[model samples]
Structure formats: structure tokens, C-alpha cells
Target chain A: MSHVNGLPKKSPDMNGNVTITDCGDSALVAKAVGLDAEAAWRLVHALADALDAVRLTGGHDVVPTYDALLVEFDCTSTDHATVRSVLAHEAARLGPHPEPITPPRHFVVPVVYGGEYGPDLPEVAAQLGLSEGEVVELHSGSDLTVRCLGAPAGAPMTDGPPFPKPVPRLASPRTRVDPGSVAAAGRQAVICPMPSPGGWPLLGRTPVRILDLHSDPITAYQPGDTFRFRPITPQQWDEYADLSLADLVDSAGLANSADLVDHHG
Target chain B: MADTLTIRTAGIVTVQDLGRVGRSRYGLPANGAADQHSARVANVLCGNDERAPLLEITALDFACVPSSDILIAVTGAPADVTVEGGVRPQWEPVPVRAGETVKVSGIRQGLRVYLAVLGSFEADRLQGSCAPDTILGFGPALSTGDELVLRTACPPLDHPFSRIPLFRLKAPVPPFPTSWTIDVTDGPDRAEFGDTGRRLFDAPFTVTPRSNHIGLRLQGEVPRRVTKGEVLSRGVPIGAVEVPAGDELLVLHRGRGVTAGYPVLAVVTATGLSALGQVRPGQTISFRHRTLDQAVAAHRAQRNAIDALRSRVRTAFDALRIRAPAGT
Candidate 1:
């Protein structure tokens, strides 16, 4: 990458595996830039700024999308072909992606399996021909990556250890899933943040409320943060009923209090 | 400080400005005037900035007494407005005498109305905005018998009667046929839908009764998700149309979720957004796709017209010879 006015210039190598995606009307997104979420994030912000400059100079209304910079032009003011040319030119000269930023903390979520909390536990266990305990062992043993946040703030989007048959959700979704329920959809896993309608196969519940709306940092997990799950008994889940979901996630053991150290704290 | 308005009956009123902007990142929806265009015009008529805080009255029956005489304007949804039992226009300025009661009663057509006072009103700003989001329980919605003190300068003119410039245009009614067109853009998940789903977007879809601030439950061709790529939850602004379960579309409005999990089908343009804003339950809506360039132009053009009309009103008001009484 070369520098123009001390700013990093976009290089041809940026095209490989790093494809730009459009999020909304005003956003352009650079995705799949390896696992460096921060690098892609910086590039997105810079491209947004560059596109904003172009809009201002051209007297157009352009906005940055979630992943892509949406370039809006006034048809009455300028031709579409001309605007496309300018976008192409900017995309070519834009700076390379920035260095990745590591998350401040990693969280290990512990979930209780079977019984009332996980209604689908028997079905999943029977399908796999494994005891409920073995299923929980497999689930809690794997390292789950933090894909992204969802509905409730800081709620994790996890690639699952794959349950048998990936049980189809309820014909009709439950009006409200109890917060802390560990749910599975297809091959993915999700920790419910608040009481919301969901159709996922719930394995068990955790005690953590990962999303704190009132707090300065709304969510605990950002992209690139690592997560692991551990199995806790339904009795253990009830023991720490009053404790938060953040407090129950453990790297090891049913309730390793030391592992529950608050990262924000 | 100017004299305040004594809310003899608050009647579901809340203080509003042009909802809190630049705070969407914090997961807070900007809960401002429901009818923003009407609110802007009302503020401009009273020589206040368009962003000034005002009383947004829902379903009327709100009455207030000005502590000191001052100028005020009301807009949005037709309501029977009067000061001391005298009738006044729904969308213009009127003078109120100090200690005299001003009342707005019965929503005739619209759902929400804006009441603006000169030099703004006395309100506690939360999260850099006086607008209240009832969903979050941040600010209190005005109830009956609530008194509001105005933190404004200058009492009413000695004469106490000011002629407000009248530029009357009837607010657009919904279920518009033939001429009414709502502009939408290609959705992020547009390609995910089959021909039938695509045709539904190309055709008109009826807005179902299940629509609200949360989202619009549309009755249209169901969109099929062919490829099952995991859609990451991300920020979805007002006017995003998503198809989650089937062919029916869920269109988001002003009080939309800051983030969503569904694949977006279309993003409505500003003009299309205006129609969506006024859409009540059971209204039929059709999507007209426009190029991104056209959407931006339409927004700018609409603003220009509104601004021009405001200037004309200001000029007419300035031309009128309403002089203050001689001071001793």
C-alpha cells in the first residue's frame, strides 16, 4: 500500500477474499477480510468518510451502510454513470485495511441441560442415541467463537457443536423465551438476552444477563472475542438463580467463581 | 422567563422535538414528533428553530394557561383549538393572554399534534433530548393537570394579537389510489426471494392491522429464503422491510428496533417514508422501487419546497403592520 498525503492508499491485493458488501441504503461494507474484524471495521469507517466527502463535493446525499458506504447522488444534479465513475475511482485509491484490535475480554458461558429449562433435550438426546449427560459434555467441551451480537445487546451468535438432526423449532414460536436460555437454530447457538419470541431448540439456561442496557458498554462480546461453554446441573443453575449470566459462565467446573470475574470491572 | 402553561388536563401529551438524532448507536430510537414535517412548519411560524421542543399532544383534551402572554402555534392532526373559548385554526399561530386558558380538544383526523411556543419551553433534557421514549421509561409522558413553565424570553406584544401567516395544505390521507406512490429500494436480501416474492414487491401489498412502531406486518407474497446464510444482527433504520418467516413483509417505522436479525428486503426512500409515517392499521401499501440517486433527490426536493413555503410565510408576516404600543 502506498501513501497519498500520509494516508494509506488502497492496493490491488485488497480485492482478494475481501469483498465489499452493501448493508443498507447508505452503507458499504468490506467483509471476509480474514478474522481481523477490526481491520475491516477501520476500512469501513474510512471509506464512509471518503464517500461522505464525495457527496459533499458533489452536492449529493450519500450515507454509509453497516458494511458498505452507500453512495447517493442527485440524478437532477449529476448523471448516474458519472457518479459510478467517481465511486470506482475512490474505491481504487482508498486506503488499505487497518491493523486488527483485540477484544478486551473473553467470556465462557455455562449452561444447564435437560429438564424444564431445555424442553427439547430429550428429543435431541434420543436422536443422537447419547445420554443427556453426554450431550451436555459435548456441548460444554467445545470452544465457540463470538460471531456477532444479536437482538439483545451482547447476545452471542455462535457456531454450534452441531446437535443431532439440528431439531426444527416449534411450529409457532414461544411468545417469550426466558432470558439465559441456550438455544440452537440450524447449526448455530444463541444466548437469549431478554424475554423475546424465539423458535430455537433450547438446551438449557444460564444465569448471565450479557446485555446491560443501562451500562456504558451495552454488550460484553465484540467480534473476535472467544467464548467457551461448560455444563452445569439444573440444581447448580437454581443455586445461582439470583446471580447474573456473566457470573455463571465458567472456563472449567460447574461453578468456578474465579472464572466469573467481570471483565468490565 | 416567560409565564407557563398550566395543564388543566394533560390528556396523553408529551414534550417532543425532532427526536433525538445521533444517538441510534447507543440502541436508543429517536422518539420525536410523529409528524415531523408538520412540527417543523409550526416551529418556523413561531420564529423558533425547527428542532425546538414542543408539546406533542396525542388525542387532545389538553388545556393550558400562559403565565405571561405569548405566541404559540399548533400543527399535526386536526384538532379543535381555542384560546379563552374562541376558535382558532389548527395549523397557525394564536395569541394567548397571561392567565388565560388555551385548550385543544378532540382529534378530528390525525393521531398526534404539535404545540410550539416562542423561544422554546422549559423541559429537562435526557440523553441530550427533551423527547420522551415511552417504551424505555426514560421521560414522563404528560398527564392531566400538569403545569409546564416556559423558559423563554419576551412576554407577548402589548396588543396581544398577532396574525399568523396561513399556508394551508391538507395533510395527505392514506389508502391513496392511482396517484399515490410509495418508493422503496432493493432490499439486502432481495435476491433471496423467488419470482413470486419478487413479484409481490413489484406489486402492491396491503398493510395489515398488526403494524405498529415495532414493525409493519404486511400481507404480500411470501419470500422464500433459498440460501441459508446466517444473517448477523445489525442496525436497521426506519423504513427497512424484512421477510422473516414467509412471504409476508415486515416493514419497520420510526419506532423500529435499532438492530434486527431478518434479511432486509427493501429500504424505503424518504418520500415513501412519509407515506409509511401516516400509515394506520389496515391501509394498503404498494412499493415503487427507485434508484438510490432518485431517493436522495426526492428528499432534497421535498425539503426545498418546505423551506420555500416557510420563507414565504415569514415574508408575509413581516410585511404586516402590527406595531407594539409606545413605552413610557
Candidate 2:
């Protein structure tokens, strides 16, 4: 492993450490090794900010995941060696250990739990040896941080405090999980942005449209954003479901009134 | 009003360009033509921009009738093109007169074919690209009787065959080996597989029928992993060769999902990726290890060759007094 400036290079197996590796001729993957949910969030955000600082230097893309960031560059314009050296220089500038200074953006996402919207709620409760109401309380109670945006367009994979017992994946994946279905597997929680085949246990369905093609930013949730599910009735879901992109932008606290006009127009 | 081309027999036809870049961060897949090399060649042959919208036809049995004169070229899979019962060769520009029906059939040796027209196709653009994302329902797929509107009008040529000599330049076609051997470099998770990773190049693997634009699933000997645990889901590149729990090898293609959970043992080179695009089901393929420097060199060489072909096409057009369609 190459050292980042004067900082000591940590091995891949070391916990809470960051390591960089060559993915191919055009990309490099910098992974935060063995980090928990909170640490992963910090590292991902820090790495994303650092990569953004050097955005103009021919880095085509910077994708932040659960605990890693993949930086892709055009080999014709900028070679791998230049990208590596730039990243190293940035790492050194940020110092050996960088802290997340920006406060995480927060949101109160409304969800309708159980019934037709979530068929696997009762089964998930039974598996965890808890009442149906208890499952809902535990699921919606904790603050979840968006660890990554993936699996599909605008899909947010969030991580929260672990439940008393780990939630297991379904034996057979469903043919299609409805869009906005909130599901949990093991300790990870994810909101299905679009209808897709999924294996996770459904806990509820959110009314917020996470992905809107017409929207300027497209995705509502970014990495490091925190959200907690607020239980709403099925009637409320119907009301919010009819909300337009402008209304969603208002409710999600995405932009100010001035920017809303531009997005709406 | 712009002239339109109506599809008579459509078989999995969709519009594709160079794809939406810098959008993967939003979990969007970088969807484009499956065989980019062939697509570029087709565009060059018809004198369109390299990233112009074109049709990517799979298992092609496609026929289209133009309302007016148009310049068209078909590349990849070596298909037979006929314009009004007259044979037209592949990899060369062919001009069809008004109300002429062009039929393409007998696609052999490969799976997909790229058809490029003179001007850009008037299609819906999502994120500044015409490439269809089948999973996301972003663009329209061609069907029988559907008219493909052209952005620019093509007036009838007094002598359509006059420019045939100008397009006689030989296009450099990439070799599609009968028994394919793809070149790959080490992936991020190579260390996790240890000796099993080295064994990936030892035997040939068969492409399974389950493969599609998403990925090329291959049946091969499962590589043993020294570590057994889930790595955090991360961004996966286009040519990543991921090995999931089932021991099957999946080479992610142009329409690959933005992220994957499987351990990636290797990544196919850019040239190897275009070659992978031509591989049909049931075909056997083997992997050959290549260094990063070598992969870079090979990619540069392929780009240089394409550049050379572009210049030759330009020279021919200039000499023949045939102006390429504007904004190409």
C-alpha cells in the first residue's frame, strides 16, 4: 500500500482505517475499513467533500457508498497516476484523521405501516418475538442516516441503531416490492425508490417520492442525511401521495421558496 | 415538416447514445450501446456525430421504410441490408431514395447490431441522453408502425449511388474470436480470493442463457474465498467481473446496476468489454490476465484506430463534394 504523503498507510484489515486500491485503469476505490454505521457515515461524507474539492481536476465521478468512495476519471484526459497523486495530496491536506464538521440534514419522513402497504410486518414481528405494535415503534423510533443512494435510482439505504435481534431476509424474494416500501434486513434499512424484486422484510411504505425525474436534483436523500419515520394513517398517505414535486420539495426542506419557483417552473 | 422512418418489423429496437455520465452518484446506471465500438463505427460510416442517437437492435429481424431520402449504415453482427430489393453492404454508407423500404436480416456471429442514420433521431432525452433505460422506463422502444422522426430533413438525391465510391474506405472491424479470450486486470477484492483469483484464468467458462444487457452471467468453477463476509455495497464499473454467492461469474455490461454486493475478482479491459458485448449465449470464453499499463495502452490504440478511420471518412466526403449532415 502506498502511503498518503507523510501519514502512515493502514492495512486493509485495520478497523476504522481508510485504504485506497486501483479498481481499473480509469477508477480508484478508497474504502473505509471495518467501520460501524456512524463511522461509515462520517468517513463517506468526509471523503465526498474532499473529492468535491478536487472536482475540477478531471475526476469524472465520485460515488459514495456505505463505507467507500469510487472515483472514476477519464484515462484519455487524466491518467490514474495523476488521480492518485491528487488524492494523496488532498488526504495530506485534510490531515491523517478528519472529522465531519457539517451538521447532518434531518427530515421526518411519514410512513403508513402494516396492511396492504406492508405485508411482511406481522412476519417480521413474529420472527423478532415482538408484538406488531412493538415492531413499528422500534422501527420508527430511531434516527436513521442515509448510508448510500443505490440499488436503484434515488433508493436510500439507511443505517440505524441495531434492533434487539437482527431481522432476517425473506426466504424467497418477492416478484416486486412497491415503490416507497420501507424494508429492513439484518441491521440495515432501505426505502425502495422504485418497484423492484427485493428480499428484505417490509415494515412500511413512505409517501415521499424519493426519485422524481422532473425534479432538479432528482434524489431527495443524500449520504449523511438523517431521517426518522413518523407514523401516519393510510388517509394521510393518500393525501401526501398526491402532492406534486413542488410540494415535496417544500415538505422535504430541499430548497428555499426562491428556488422552489425555478424547480416548479 | 421533418421526414420520418416507420418501423415495419421491430425486434427489441431501442435508441442509444454514449449514455448518461456523472449520474451514477444518484443510483442511475450508465446505459448506452452494448457494443460501443460498433456503434461508433456505424455513426462514422453515416457521417453522424460519434455520440449521435442510433438504434441498437438485438436478434435483429428489423425493417424500416423512410418517407424521404436518407443515409444509413449498419454495423455489428454482420447483417444483410437490402434497400428496395437491392443489396447494400455493411460498414459502408448507403443512401436510400424517397419511400424506399430498408430491410435488415440474417444477423450472424454476434447478438446486437447498430444502425446509424445521417442526422440525430428525434427521441426523448433523459439526462441529456437518448439511451433507453428499460428498467427505469426513461425512453421509448421502437415498435411496428412507430415513426422515428429525423431532426433534419434529407432531400432526395438526384444520383443516390454517386456517393457509394466515397464510402468505399475500409472500416477497421475488431476481431471477434471464435473461441474468445478476454483480457482482465485485478479487481479491488482480488486479495480476498487469494489463490482462487489466480485460478480464474485457468479454464474456459460458458455464457449462460440468463445473461442480458444487465450482465453476462457465466457458468464456471467457483473461486474459493479466504474471507467470508459481506462487504459494504459499492459502486461497480461497467466491465466489473463480480462473483456472487452462487459461484457464477457475472460480467457487468453497459446497463449494469450502479452498485453491487458481490466480490469482484477482476475487471475486463475497455477493448475486452466491447468484445464481451458481441458474445452470444452458449459461447465459451476464457480470461487472460493483463496489467493496468497494458490495458491503458490497448485502449489508447483502439481510440487511435477509430480516429484514423474518422479522418479517412472525412477525406472521402470532402473529395466527393458530399457535405456531411450539419451538427453531426
Error of 2 at B84 (Å): 1.4
Query: What DockQ, on C-alphas, does every prediction get?
Result: 0.18, 0.52
Could you tell me which 10 consecutive residues in candidate 2 chain B have the lowest summed lDDT?
B157-166
Which TM-score value belongs to model 1?
Answer: 0.72
B3-102 per-residue lDDT for model 2 (tens digits): 8989999987888887877777777887888888899889988778888999988876999988877888888887788888878888877777778888
Q: Which stretches in model 1 have alpha-carbon errors above 4 Å?
A: A1-98, A108-135, A153-170, A179-182, A186-188, A199-214, A227-265, B1-34, B55-70, B98-110, B122-141, B146-149, B157-180, B201-204, B221-237, B309-328
At residue B95, give the lDDT of candidate 2: 77
Per-candidate RMSD, Å: 7.3, 5.1
Q: Tell me, by TM-score, which candidate is best.
A: 2
| i-RMSD of model 2 (Å, 1 decimal) | 1.6
Could you give candidate 1's per-residue lDDT for residues B181-286 as a string of tens digits? Answer: 5787766567776564466456567777776545678886666666676554456656777777755678776666465656677777756665565555555667
TM-scores, each model vs. reference: 0.72, 0.88
The chain A TM-scores for the candidates, taken one by one, are: 0.60, 0.77
